[model samples]
Target: MKPETPFYITTPIYYPNAEPHLGHAYTTVFADILARYHRLIGDDTFYLTGTDEHGLKLQRAAEAKGVTPKEFVDSMVAIYRNFWGLLNISYNRFVRTTDEDHIKVVKYAAEVMYRKGLIYKGNYSGWYCVDCEKFYSASEYLMIDGRPHCPIHRKPLEWTEESTYYFRLSEFREYLLNLLKNKDIVYPKHFRQEVINKIVGQELLDISIARPKERVWWGIELPFDKNYTVYVWFDALLNYLTGINYLSDKERFRRYWSSTHHVIGKDILWFHTAVWFAMLKALDIDPPKKVLVHSFIINKGLKMGKSSGNAVRIEDLLGRYLSSDGVRYLIARIFNLGKDVEVSTSLLDSIYNSELADNLGNLIRRVGVLIKKKLKGTLSSESIDNTLTDKADTAVHKFNKLLGEEYEISTALQEVMGLLKEANAYINSVRPWELSDPSKELYTLMEVVKVAINLLYPVIPESVSKVAESFSIQLGNPLDISVDVGKEYVVKEAPILFKKVR
Candidate 1:
């Protein structure tokens, strides 16, 4: 929590075969909000997001387009980076599984595991879905009318027999179970329970960690076998650490990895929780501090349901709102922790209209407009009345109290919104517009309104900064986590924070 201590977090490096979507925007926004909030509270946070370019999925997509895998991944990655950049998502590092440093670290992790006898030769024969990018155990694969179907794609999985190197995952059952019991290995508590109740609840299978070096040559080549490439997960999984590997960059890796957290999807819980921990322990490194698994975004109020043709795309949301924060705010507000949220344009519109426009935005406009009219464009640092202030006096307190312990962004925003709502109602009842008089009593009442605007600085900052400047009050002074409201405050000028959405 200290500024000097690193708070390292990462999104699951995305597969680059498809264009980015709402699902991609969901977790990145979640992490970005946390990053922005923590930095505001003085935490030294580092957030990493990027594409996982090398996989059989990308390889096949490239072939279908008649382009080399490199060409396909190169162009696709550009689109992903540009999309995130457009949304103002500030990622500290954009990791690629195909990067030279990552390739070496993956090989290093494999070699260490292999040298420690955690690796062994094996033959894998199963229904493998290239599109799904995962091998299904018979229990998981749906036998549709007789053929194996991908649980995700709901299509048949290709059967394959390959000379592969397997990680003896089944042997780590009790080890992983104890780690789960320990609870710090993964987090958001409920998702960890899901991992225990579901996949890890089933018998752990020895995972195929390498493919025939020739067939799936898109991944890190195994150090122990020139004939095989390390499996996507076996290497791809280590990126959380490779960005700060002990053997490679001991001090930096140790500092960062010791406090790492992974924000991942619920579907991939098995790899992050069970397999990832097993690999790190074999290498004598500690597992990540926590793994936060969030469920996917659903359409039409159910997470997995699809519409007739199109699903909710982040692109569409951005096109409509011209702001990613609206999308981020909806995702944060609507979903309970680790649960899927169905997003519709209607849901997006409702939040934007109700929360941002009406509550937050209208409060600023009503207050700023009245101050300008009454005070004659001169910002007031004069004391205001407590009649209007008393109604919402607890809001600033509630925001700091809730977020002081841990950054609950939505909850804090809600508290701030609650106060804004109260201030708007108070202004309506007191008729601060009619309170524009020369009396000392009337001047005191206007000061209370200015204090309320000062309280709103955290959530909708830009407008409030204008409010601060209009009165010539110092904005940054009260922005600190330990901020306190001054007795006298004034609005310098009115600047519009929210333009009415067409």
Candidate 2:
């Protein structure tokens, strides 16, 4: 048999300086959904996500807690892992920047670039944000009270001068420009233009890739120079290679790396695109197959972040929704790749209530109960209704097109929800509950429900699985789903998939 097509996806290794929050959950859940979708379609998928443990910010945070850097990160990493587990993130590998293999990868890459004359020692002076772990040019920083401040954090920027090793990012400006123009490498075509515009507007300068050990000592030390450590961003980015077994397993690495998709937030666009592309070129490696960028989840008129002090806690959402699937569905429902999503409890509650509880949950309850109560829990084969079948088929088609082709996850979900709405309407029109022999109508409705639930499985796996099991429905490949009127459906029980949030 031919092998399943390889599909590799990754989330940015999060910085574990703070606990996991809504922002973290947003990105990770989105990646998880895509990963789950690929797996559902019979793809050999690998999802990678984890923590970035080395930086000056982490060093000071550890000091403030009176613990060693490793000790603090150990605890924080545990929290991140626990939170991911709570959210049902099905990551194939959880890579840490401090892992020995990752550290080695960073050092190896740096050494290759150094030998190729792409990295050189240089003195650097710039406005920097400790929170961001990045330097900002004059045009990049915001001026508040006549002083430079971090655009994201809204905090004062620090002026620092140090000797560091620099990567020749400027040399690859033409290469990156040509790359961004390909239009297929970055999703949401506008983001590709955004990167191209940035490269065209500003001269791509050589980026500092190392920090002096005297100031920040928690990172991977350079192989050639023990006095300097690899910059946090540089070190963190290599976790992608480490996660794919870049150095340890060549055949496996080649198979997965050929199909890599890096799912990242818009804030890191520059590094992931311009700098990352250059680094890969310097290492004689090809760029990733695609770089998927997403806008942020906003709260209180600011991008939700721990440092911004506007981050919503993940626990709070779980408490409100009462299940990981609820939170996942809400996020998938509101997810946007092009624009920022402003989140509020009211908005979330409305979506959960209207979509999950009222629409999907209601359909499942009605169908299962009707089958058990009226049909004696047994549904025999009968001719399927063409109207409901057409709606289900269109929904399946649009869903696959929007999600698989356009990567419009929210739009894809809307298509599925529309199917549910149609099924609910069909129920009202046919009045299955009132009919003495509504076996055909019920079977038709069940087929539509089967399609809708299968489409929703990626976003709400647990809830969908429960509904499928209760109705004895076979969750098959979404692309090939059709109205199976000949199959027998034995309803064991009507499961309450999602409880309405009061």
Candidate 3:
């Protein structure tokens, strides 16, 4: 990828009916890491994340709270913004479905679809999951204790019938099947297979695109019909287009939309790959360049939920760690890209102590102390060590390859830590403390540390910044493994990067 090339990516807009949890933070943080990596390598990157505020669920929850839906969403959105700030999420834009610009684009898309004969007047009768704000047929819901309940939420399903506008989703059945056949539509082949089975197994029915305005008054009103409101899902999906100002700014939209990626959870694969892609085809627009589907973060073999008392709050986890970077480090280290990960406080503590505090932190502090004491806090430039150079090159190459191809974040971090362990072993073998003049050996050690920090800057921004400051090097240098060996380096007094937890 060239520096001038553009890269656009997004995390699905969270449904803010409740507080943010580990699942929400997980996806957003992963997107941020990729965006940062693109920027570090000099790409024009745009990263977006936000909340979904308007839906039947939001209206019902707001009524129960004795406040209007807008007021309720306003308070809930603040919570999401605060948590993302605490975790240092680097998103270029925070888009909400209710924003004026976003609303305009969504309405524009609905109107365009209606004009293309892709949407038509229809009636719908089925089981509706109010919690998910989605409609399900009989086969989609599960039977529980003689009554039908939503498979996703495990709550009683509501039987409802209404006059609705329907999108001709079935018309795109073959279109979607052919689209999914392309490997770039969804990664990790297995997930793509799941999508294919879903479309093939179930009869592809035309989906409802509007709800009677008298019943759900909080959503965007349909431009063609005064008595109905655009379906929340229709409005929500347009957010991807909103990132480039699809309705108002044409040139900008073309620039970014040409190559776009979506980071989503496994649960929403059908929504993104099937429905979202179908809508794009109806509009005669190209589908997103790719979709990166990831698994959930669970506890005790169950998905994290507030009612289950297993959901871990971002604030609670951050408070337990020495720095926010510690929390970020552990999550990225333990996260399995395509499988669910079980998280516990004990697991977090153990990983932090062993890899971060013992291996990585110990290396930085030891090297910094040696130079400050023996070499008078000054480093003389020396040719890069061949052995260490090979190790650094291999780590950087592996990191880039994994992130670019497999999206294997945890595995990438393991490779970087492997390089750090090698550096630590070199220190013990050379025993630089015994050398009256250890400038050359110390220089190599510092170079290794510098390379490690640069590679990790995307994952742990705060801690890496502190490391660069201690060595008096400019942060955000172009991505590379080579250090500036000709320039004299100065070491400064700084606090320990990671403190060992008891």
Task: Assess every candidate by TM-score.
Answer: 0.85, 0.94, 0.93
Return model 1's CA RMSD, one decimal.
4.1
Of the two candidates 1 and 2, the one with more favorable lDDT, higher being better, is 2
* TM-score attained by model 2: 0.94
Off by over 4 Å in 1: 1-3, 128-160, 198-200, 245-248, 301-310, 381-397, 400-408, 437-492, 500-502
Global lDDT of model 2: 0.89
Q: Which stretches of candidate 2 lie over 4 Å from their true place?
A: 127-160, 301-308
Q: Show how many residue pairs clash in every candidate, following the order shown.
A: 13, 0, 0
Query: What's the C-alpha lDDT at position 367 in model 3?
Result: 90
Query: What number of backbone clashes does candidate 3 have, counting pairs of residues 3 or more apart or in separate chains?
Result: 0
Off by over 4 Å in 3: 1-3, 127-159, 301-308, 476-478
* lDDT by residue for model 3 (404-426), tens: 66788899999889999999999
The CA-based lDDT of model 1 is what? Answer: 0.68
Candidate 2: worst 10 consecutive residues by lDDT? 300-309
lDDT of each: 0.68, 0.89, 0.84
